[model samples]
Target: MINPLGRLLDENNYIVSDGAMATELEKRGVDTNSALWSAEALIKNPEAVIAVHRSYFEAGAAIATTDSYQATPQAFVEAGFTKAQGAQFITQSVQLAQAARDEYLANLPREERLAKGGALLIAGSVGPYGAYLADGSEYRGDYTLTDAQYRDFHRERMQLLADAGVDLFAFETMPNAAEVKALCGLLTDEFPGMTAWLSFSVGASSTALCDGTPLDAVATMANDCDQITAVGINCTAEENVTATLHTLTPLTAKPIIVYPNNGDIYNPIDKSWQANPNARSFAALAPEWRAAGASIIGGCCRSTPADIAGMATALAAQN
Candidate 1:
């Protein structure tokens, strides 16, 4: 079989899947918010990461992301590790995904495979520089970093993924177009052969990104970036996606990928994120998104393996 992700984009069609959240997964054992847990968990429980990846693939995900989103120097500080110590964690994240892919492919039926055989694509996920601000405030006023500084930090982590043979580098959940543009240029300049996938969080109806850049502007940046293969949204409101999708389809020629959060904003008081839209929602919407020109479909926050399985069934039926 052709690469599932490559085929999905090549045909300008939607292929359903799920994106795993390391925060939520780590929460099961250690309070996800705790500092020591991240360091300990990164070393002690590669299985947990592997388990999540296996679950997504078994549930029918065409792609699985590495657990490297939180492997930054600042995150290491929060996790009780020195900046220098983060390298091992970053390398391990890639290794964890590779293990999951190997195990998944091995378990496939020994016979009846296609001529090209099954190849699972591993996407290395990179998130915002800082953890979601505790209060979700804008980073502009409180802190500012030169483009070079930002590139330096991101490049260190990107190199780990590239060296470990990641199938793609996903700049995911970015709230600003400028950040994405800089990171894209930095990566493309460094790793010219690797595929880049850019995803934004739409804060509202009018903005391409949460920071309020025009949707066309995001499209233009994604297009101009040498290695960008796809662009779309993740971590936006479900209600926000419909209009955003409509707006995005006409402005950009690239394949659109959508993975809105399953639950709305988390309410710290009750510690619950409500409005559970399951796989059925994904099943129902995948076609509409495809009709609107989305080439990939998946889940973001609060999405589990079952959600991906549901999407897979939906995609198979539609195809």
Candidate 2:
């Protein structure tokens, strides 16, 4: 099967992905303070979830990532859902995104829709096991699990997403090398015909992953995996992006995807975001990030539709 994302990049040079789902949901008056984070909207306010995805597409995003980042069975069970119910919710996440994509396209004129790039794709978001913890361990990468354990935790959701018809998988915000390896292996061994992008959660230093693994080391591992179509960083500070891209560009022939946070620091303790005086706008940084070699660009935590619009405008100016 032809990879639509690859085709789009071949035609357009860069692909614009959507911004943070959780951030958008919060703006829609949904409560996301629970362990499920944005997944809470899946159960409580699914229409709101659809609205968020549509807003991003309207803002010029060519890809819409699902709200399944924290929708794992373990998390749902801990939050008082049965495993089967959790599975349904995971499937629902994909459907919600598809609904948004369909609705967005229906209103657009046929010519405008065709001109909006290629088909708008839905990336099934497979967040790290740390996201299941909901305690900020994703940033620290302080957890450990055997390869079997990691695959077991992820398999059900991957299957659900595939069955629900996602365009690709997004193994995003990953911090642990072992888990990354497990996921890559699982994708190859089980989910044939699927493609994915692996984006890391890096620490303050751009040279290292959140787990302290050298960026070059993990990036090289991902680049070697045939099933992974792109490799780079996400949910990290915007300041770390260009440097992280510089480290990654030489390591992989795959496209580099970077969607850093909105230049804000997250206090995982209170689960609140604090503004950084030094944070720059995505419009201002888009040219620099593109110049540094990112072929897929968007926003992460605390990023809004406006931020994506700015990045899209900035990238459009490049051609």
Candidate 3:
């Protein structure tokens, strides 16, 4: 299959990715209080998942990231689901995104569809093992696993995503270098036809990953991998994004993709998000991130379709 993302980047300097999935679902009245998070919608309210994806598309996003970030087989098993049921839910995540993309494009005017690149891509969200822990380990990167073990944990979900027909993978919020290396190996060796963009979750310092590995080192590691189509940061603070992009641009020629949180700090203990007074709007920050070398920009946690609309407008002004 042709790489639609690469082609879109070739035609346009920037692409707008979708905003937060779970938070958007919450706005639609889905309960995400459990560890399953947005994946819970797959079983109880699948239409709501489609609505969130369509909302991003209507907000000017060209990529619809699937709601499979925390929908791993292990997570389902822990929730008392059979392994087969876990796989079904994972596949349903992609199907839901596809439904939204197809429905949105079909109803759009021909001129508008052409203006938006004529095609919307689905990125299967492959969040880190830390996300499955649901204890904020994704931000801490406190866990360790052998490369083989890491591969075992990720393989089933990735295969499900691929078989379900995602255009690419979004390895977002990755914090561990060992796990990333394992993923790269898995892609090259097992899924050579597939491609993905690896985005990291960094600490406040912004120069290193949450695992304490230097950003340049891990960025270089991912850049060296042929299957990694883009490299940058996501689910990080807005303040750290520009500096992190500056850190990454000089290291790799690959496209830089960034989708930061809406500047709300997460309290892992109580599982709540508190407002950050300093958080700036995406309308004001999107241009700066583009200037800093981000080719793809959007929001992460706490970011809504309104925020993505701001980014789309801000980025359009660049031309």
Candidate 4:
């Protein structure tokens, strides 16, 4: 059973997903300091959110992850939105991405717009529970929550996103195997038609998850789940790219997805973001990433549209 994403890889060798939702939003003057992150734009500035997606599309992002990574009902309710409103906001996250795709397609030459293959896709983002806590615990993954508890925590938003209609799930920045296991189970049991891509954040050691679990063991867990269509790393420092890819590419037969951040560091505890002066050159590294077997690549935190466009242009030039 070939995943659709697999077909895209076969055709193009690599496809670009969008770069940094919150970081891009902040560039447009949206305040991302709240627990909601870019999810806030889904309510007060949906059109602004849509515009960002359009920017990425114009810049060559083939997939746009929704602006709902931090948009759980609990978070919204805690921020004073009602449960129903929270659900609508989640659904609207997909809507905004779709709107961007449609608008982008509409403007292309008819032949380009009507191309039978490689159309844009929307990935409903499912941020880990620790993301809601906003305490950087997502990078620690030492929570005592049971598997069922984790599943319970993710259920509502997952269902709403599925109902809203997305091409796949982007379980972004997961730090442990447990959350991956829990979400994979629920996808199998609940959203029968849905498949997901799981991207883990590498920990202090470049070869391990933030929880210190070896990528090999985690890759094994992900490989056993039929619901997961792809597996790789994201939101990790650019310096970790080579080791992370070396550890992962051999471990999974699935397509590799690697979207590393600029070497910037974020402290969820103090909500401070300091620049990593040592950040690697993202554009110069794309060829190596492709050579190393990353079939899907893009930028995460601090990666701009120009950065993604540069990668896309580079791939085009190679052909």
| lDDT scores of the candidates, listed in order | 0.68, 0.91, 0.91, 0.85
| Prediction 3 TM-score vs. true | 0.97
lDDT of 4 at 266: 76
lDDT of 3 by residue, 28-146 (tens): 89999989988999988999999999999999999999999999999999999999999999999999999998889888898976765456889999999999999999998889999
Candidate 2 local lDDT, 1-319, one digit each (tens): 4576788897888988999989889888999998999999999999999999999999999999999999998899999999899999999999999999989988999898777635699999999999999899899899999999999999999999999999999999999988998999999899988989999999888788888998778877787778799898999999998888888888888899999999989998789988899899999998898899999999999999999998899889886
Evaluation by TM-score, superior candidate among 1 and 2? 2
Model 1 gets an lDDT of 0.68
What global local distance difference test value does model 4 have? 0.85
Quote the RMSD, in angstroms, for model 2: 1.2
Better of 1 and 4 by lDDT: 4
For model 4, state the Cα shift of residue 181 in Å.
1.2
Candidate 4: tens digits of C-alpha lDDT, residues 201-242:
777586787877888888888898887889988887787887
Worst 10 residues of 2 by lDDT: 110-119
Q: Candidate 3: where are CA atoms >4 Å away? A: 114-118
Candidate 4 lDDT for residue 22: 86
